[model samples]
Target: MLQLVDFIARNRFFLVFVLLEIFSGWLIVRSNSYWGATYFNTSNYYVAKTLAFSNSAREYTRLGEINSDLANENARLNALVATLSQKNAKDAPVGYVPDSAFNARFTYKVAKVVDNETNRTNNYITIDKGSADGIEPDMGVISATGVVGKVRFCSKNYSIVTSILHPQFMVSSKLIRSNEIGTAKWPGKDPNFVDMVDVSRYTKVYKGDSAVTSNVNAVFPPGIMVGKVKSVTVHPDQTFYNIVLELATDFRNLSYVYVVKNRQLGEQETLKQRLGDRR
Candidate 1:
């Protein structure tokens, strides 16, 4: 307290000057319209800028949560659409009601990608869902834009996906325009592209043609986008075109994904096993 008194005594003159300056500025602002307007405008500008910066910061922190919500919403909508489309099919069983007759073949479970890798020869992604959440090893994984991978392994609360970027990962795909079937495989090189092999050269494929999951696949439902063809070239020694595709899902930017649970997969597998035994 004594030291503060001594310091104030020493700076008394300077403190008085500062106080007077502040008073004078306040008077000018209060008495003069121009100064008052300038003061208010300056304060408003700073306040608005501060608020905007704060809001942006808050939003940045919530990006993951926001993405997860959107993914789940999309999953719900997609599942509903699939159900309705099937129900309205002309070949749907007689006496089919949209509610009772509709079988939920595929349902999506939203999950956050806890880990992702795209720079390796065989990349994989880990999600924060597992058997407890109905995630299974063979379930298909997809992003909002398109296919990501398939669940390779799972625990009670987490799962690892063999990313579509993996060399060993293959998806049965077909050209959207020509309906020519092919196999989508990563060439063990570029992270931005996948190769659609076994597409015959005679197929009506073009540079910008799209490849999508075939309806016949048990994992992904029909028409899930795989990629757009970046290049299509005829190799000299092969009857198939060397086609490259720009992957629909950007693995580097992936935050949320949906695991496709095909409810009939087990039934299909069991039937297939029985048929194989007969053969």
Candidate 2:
């Protein structure tokens, strides 16, 4: 206490000067409109800047949560769009429907690709949805841009996807211009390219031809984009066309995907079995 008193006594002259300076400034601002206006303007400027900084800080902290919410909303909208598209396709006249049966074969459920890989030979992806979310094995997966892959396995909260880059992945795809369908396969060479085989050379295929799911095998819905023709070559001795397709989706950057579920899958399977039994 005695030390504190001595310190204060020592600094009393400086403290008094500081207080006097503050009082003089206040008096000048209060008595003069010009000074008051100047002071107010400076104060207001600092206050506005501080408030803006504070608000920005708060918003920055909330960015992740906001992004997640937005992604979920986007997924919901995609699901609604898929549903509506399916309904419209089904309502069309039966005679108008294509004979391929791929156009109306599957339904879609939206999911986010929480984890993805592309550089490996057997690349796989993990989605933030599972069987509990109506995902199932063999369900076709796609994004807004194009087809992704199919669900391989699922748990309650997550699922593993067999990426289109996987060697085991095979999709029934066809040229949009010529309607020449073939088996789409990945040769483990490029993540951006897939091989479309069994297409006859006489199909009139060329570079830049759009390819889509054939839906003939009922694995994926027809019209789901597979890729575009990047190159076409006829095998020396074979009658088939060796076509290279450039995938529409950037596999390394996949963020969101939709798992296609055929609501009538069970009925379709049962009918197939019955037909086989009769045969």
Score candidate 2 by TM-score against the native.
0.73
Model 1, span 79-183: residue lDDT tens: 886676666754457886755333468899999899999898789999999999888899999988889999999999999999999999999998978879999
10 residues in a row with least lDDT, candidate 1: 96-105
Off by over 4 Å in 1: 84-103, 235-237
Using lDDT as the measure, which candidate wins?
A: 1
Q: Can you write out model 2's per-residue Cα lDDT over 1-279, one digit (the tens) per residue?
A: 999999999999999999999999999999999999999999999999999999999999998788667766765665565455555664367666443333344556667789998989998999999867877888888887788988888999999999999999999997888878898889999999999999998769979999988747555666778899999988679899889999988888787787877766777889999999999
Report the Cα lDDT for residue 198, model 2. Answer: 90
How far out, in Å, is residue 42 in model 2? 6.2
- Evaluate model 1: give its lDDT: 0.89
Clashes of each: 0, 2
